[model samples]
Target: MSDDKDVVIKEYTAPAGGWGSMKGMSKILPKEGISPDVLDALRRQNKPEGVMCVSCAWGKPAKPHIAEFCENGAKATAWELTSHRVTPEFFQKHSVSELAEWPDYDLEQAGRLTHPMKYDAATDKYVAVGWQEAFDAIGAKLKTCDPTKVVLYASGRASLETSFMYSLMARMWGQQNLPDSSNMCHETTSVGMKSAIGSPVATIQLEDYDKCDAIFVFGQNVGTNAPRMLHTLQECRERGVEIVTFNPLRERGWERFASPQSPVQMTVGAPTKISSQYHQVCAGGDISAMLGICKYVIEADDRAQTEGGERILDHHFIAQHTVRFDDFATFCRNARWEEIVDESGLSRNAIEGAARVYMKAERVIAVYGMGITQHRYGIDSLYMILNMLFLRGNIGREGAGPGPVRGHSNVQGQRTVGITEKTELAPVERLKELFEFEPPTEKGWDTVESCREIIAGTAQGFVQLGGNFLRATPEHAAMKEGWAKLPIAVHIATKLNKSHLYPGEESYILPCLGRMEQDMQTGGRQAVSMEDSFSHIYGSVGKATPAAETLLSEPAIIAGIAKALLPDNPNVPWDEWVGDYGLVRTAIENVYPDKFANFNERLFVPGGFWKGNPASHREWQTDSGKAEFNVPRALNASGFAEKEGRFRLVTLRSNDQFNTTIYGYDDRFRGIKGTRMVVMMNRADIAHLGIADGDTVALESDAEDGIERVVEGLRVVEYNIPEGCLGGYYPELNYLIPLEHHALESHVPAGKSVPVRVRI
Candidate 1:
């Protein structure tokens, strides 16, 4: 919120990790005041004996490293295990009006909420309320409203058991309005891959990285996003795998990385080079770049066939396992070279070089992130990548497939366990048969639509499991205004967040246990289950004591509310399920027999059992029963019309933060410090706009969508990004992205790619 432009922006000389990550770890460990015993226990996280890291959804190995946690994971654990607490006295000392002016980091550092509290209108303060009273009030409000007017929102941090129970309870209460965090990020990955290959999740496992001959990473900043994936990339490099990257900026993790676990590298100050070739794709130019590669592959195959040489494409695999190759090839061949070069923002030779690497590899894996999915044509871009992989028979093989790095810890698991607005008919029928309740067949609102409804004053109530929906969502100013229309707002959370501060007419904050706390239920200490990015399900048992004595586990809190709402319903057995999570898994197994059979038994496995993807096993589950090639039209130079000072904005997460949670102000890899409201721009772009390196500026949305979004006081920083493409930290830039500007089919906010005009 400060307009000062004196923020420090230095050059980080070292690569991703040598001593920098170690320094960060050392600084965080002491700040949390973790004892030796607790630190030792946290070190065993993600192992068979320990709980999982409550961070990104990156898959862990069968036998994880001795130090299984990364910098981000350590920060998350430290933040959760902090010794601070937001007691009743703290709430009495600070009013909502006073706390509203505080920053996000300050709000979180105030400590975890220790009790259930209700907002007092006259006093402008939250007063501690008994758990039963809070539940009764919420249930009363829910009972009066039509089911369609209520929205049951969820965060990715919730466990599988809790998500399943909540989904069922929401449906039984007569609604399917489940808007989750996945709807904001990777919904396109699901909708896109389903249309292309009949599968939505990643088709490859962690071990596949070692066996793959080549890897193509598009639009992901692995160093800041999912650092643990770097270990696999290093192993791939040692195996002589060709690594090619497509990004607007040269991410340090993709440039070079030194695993701190290795003594030799740490002592000698040497690191393994990650990407063999880096292609700087323009913001929103991923589809164009992918199409260029596909065109080259098709042309190379044509030349090989005419000369009677070894075919560049797998004709046999294409003929048997895939359909519509002729039409796809024809479209690719007809695409003009000039248009491809212009749209991709790269030379034709560079695109051809990438194609050569793709053709040479016997097996290849294509990994993508939000940069590819958060766009106007995100689905089409994903299909373009799948189309290239199909041309070379890269999928359904030992070490080759499509991989989408999920952003949150259990985002995929939440979706897998029926926490979705558009719940399929099969699952609906199964739930009806098992629970004797008919789930709504009508498609419900997603995150974007739900916000629209709230703004339009149509929604009656809103309840969130964990995420900071107000801060993380696009069009925050409008969202806050919409949130005021809700009659009741409930948050089941561990800590204070920006969303909790924005209360409705009747608001309640019910604090819950963190992932690292022992959930001492009626039976004994209980463990929760989660599915990783690769669909690997395993048990996570916490050994640490609870942060606050009054906090309840997520599942227990959900069951308490459910029991209050359905007081006479005898079919649910809510008490029994909360007492023993195994019963919940049993119910899930009965619901998804084919997907999660023997769900409880699998938890005892050393690592975990795979949920299985049909496409990975060479079985197509599509309407055609084959992987179909989609021929999408080539995109233009820019998705939006260009103005003199307009630039494409790509919202990014800093190295010191996660989704909507700011751990610190610095982005180490980017050499930015003590600031979140800064815009990274190309030197040429800065010069063209007559702006200096640290000039304060305001960014306004370019689209004439009738909504004016202008974020002020963001200092400009010159960086090595592509011209006409600017970068800024997320949640701050989120205000400039319109609610209506989202993916076509999935409706995911295009936060990664937005068009804006900058002014001094």
Candidate 2:
């Protein structure tokens, strides 16, 4: 109830059976047996403690002592702490085929996996076995296949030590397949940033936001996805720093945020003022928007040059520290303004207004998230952002640079510690020099390539460190088929997921310790390092006890596997390193000498440490040791659907959700209550289609191989979104994502751009 004219009051009604009745009931009364304790746990699972809290070990270590968990962190804990248990007895009662029919939530909600289980083809059920026995059996099965047939897939949830050991084992065994979660998320930032600058990380720091005069956030919904960032944005807004947002949907969080931490705002119901100006741009329109900004800057520079005034372009910095400016400038000049306005779904005035703001700001920060990466041209789009930043000598500066807000804690850290398929030349030579073993010089298979190899039956085994690979990847049918084709598949995970259920000829599910669980190694109490989106490296130590004693740390599991594989190597003691994470940190310090100095000492601090990048001071680390500008072409993009009467659909996450997991049914901020079965649309477009507010529609993707997904009887919420754009939650509508539709360089599924025609 703010008196401000910009503040609007909206009323919402809760759906039938309370907020999460349908989802809760679905978990309880599934077509299978349910334990009473499991049911009771599910009923009372919304407590302040449990699995949801355990899973989020990201920024918790750095948080003030009083505040423990965020909303999504609690949801993640609730998800893991569910009372359900899919025991050996339960598995014996049901076949894998039967369990596969159940929804992902129902399958996972069945409960904590108490023992290691292996798929038995004869009984068609997963049978319990001793840990050692399971490991030996897996080892035997792996030995039967060629090392090249095995692919090790890792997730962002894994720690740096675990990832390093996993990579070491894979390399020692001669398998170069390392398909990881980074491929699905921030691979574009990695590839694009490396090409633009020598490093593939954001040069900006969290403290830099305080110094920024203006901020431009593209495609990221900080309110829901990364709530912690909202505090920074709120502080900046309060100080009158100009904030501009570019996204297809005018997300409520970006409009206003009610921080639970603020006593005054919480009591008065005063929400944080979000964007000074919001632009509802079309999907995949980032390139145009960036180019338009550059064009305006160039125009301003020309005016300054002619009038003998202050130059809009940082002429001194650009000349001293950048190359190829003339070529990039020419490309921007040739780009038609009409095309930029039309493609971006922004008016000329809006584009000019944004450009004017960009030109005035001395220190600007452009932050983007998955929405900018999960597209066909994601890498190129990122390059455009770098080009724009380079035009003003923004990169490597105090408050100006490109920031890709990565999801998960260590997605970037995992990549930094040699979890990539394409190993760098320096890392390879360094590994050989350090370990005395010749590392593989050739490029390895990425996620898409690994999946393709699995489908082709060339890859016979898959070993996952963490994550739901099957559910996370595109082409669900092919992903499942690829698993079945494998001779053996091993999943090292904390709990049960759909990916674990995809049985191969031989499959093993090895339960590992969760992030929030105490990890007691030979080092006494071990602390693991994780890198945030802002290139800040920090240590995390779990406060909670282990869910089960049988669970092993990720590093220990990798070391055990490596011990079995490489019985004779002497470069580094795998057992010693596994026992103490500090030993592993020493190795990391040796490998990445430039970034991690005094790695052990620095990690002991509460704030952990920052991986210092001198480039933040405008030191370009590109090929010529200078920031390079990329010139984008105006040729008609090929992947866009040309079908008549079709609009592109962008998949997104709800306030109560994360990737591939639905925490609750209520998207409270979006005015969505009780269910995710709804789509945001432009009111004018919905009326033109003769579709009412509530109607059942089948959305068929324009991609030749894309499947038609039916979101039964969804209520269309008409809002201030761009025309020809639709928004829906992912996984439910993930079926619309085609197997072949992905970004060119990164191969991330084009989850943001799927042309579809809706039919009633």
Q: For model 2, what is the alpha-carbon lDDT of residue 362? A: 89
Which TM-score value belongs to model 2? 0.90
Tell me each candidate's TM-score.
0.98, 0.90
In model 2, how many backbone clashes occur? 12
Q: What is the overall TM-score of model 1 with all chains considered together?
A: 0.98
Cα displacement (angstroms), candidate 1, residue 249, comes to: 1.2
lDDT of 1 by residue, 589-684 (tens): 999888899999888576677999999987988889999998875473234755676789999998888998878787889989888989999999
Clashes of each: 0, 12
Error of 2 at 328 (Å): 2.2
In terms of lDDT, which candidate is strongest? 1
Largest TM-score belongs to which candidate?
Answer: 1
Query: How does model 1 fare in lDDT?
Result: 0.87
* lDDT, residue 530, model 2: 73
Cα displacement (angstroms), candidate 1, residue 127, comes to 0.7
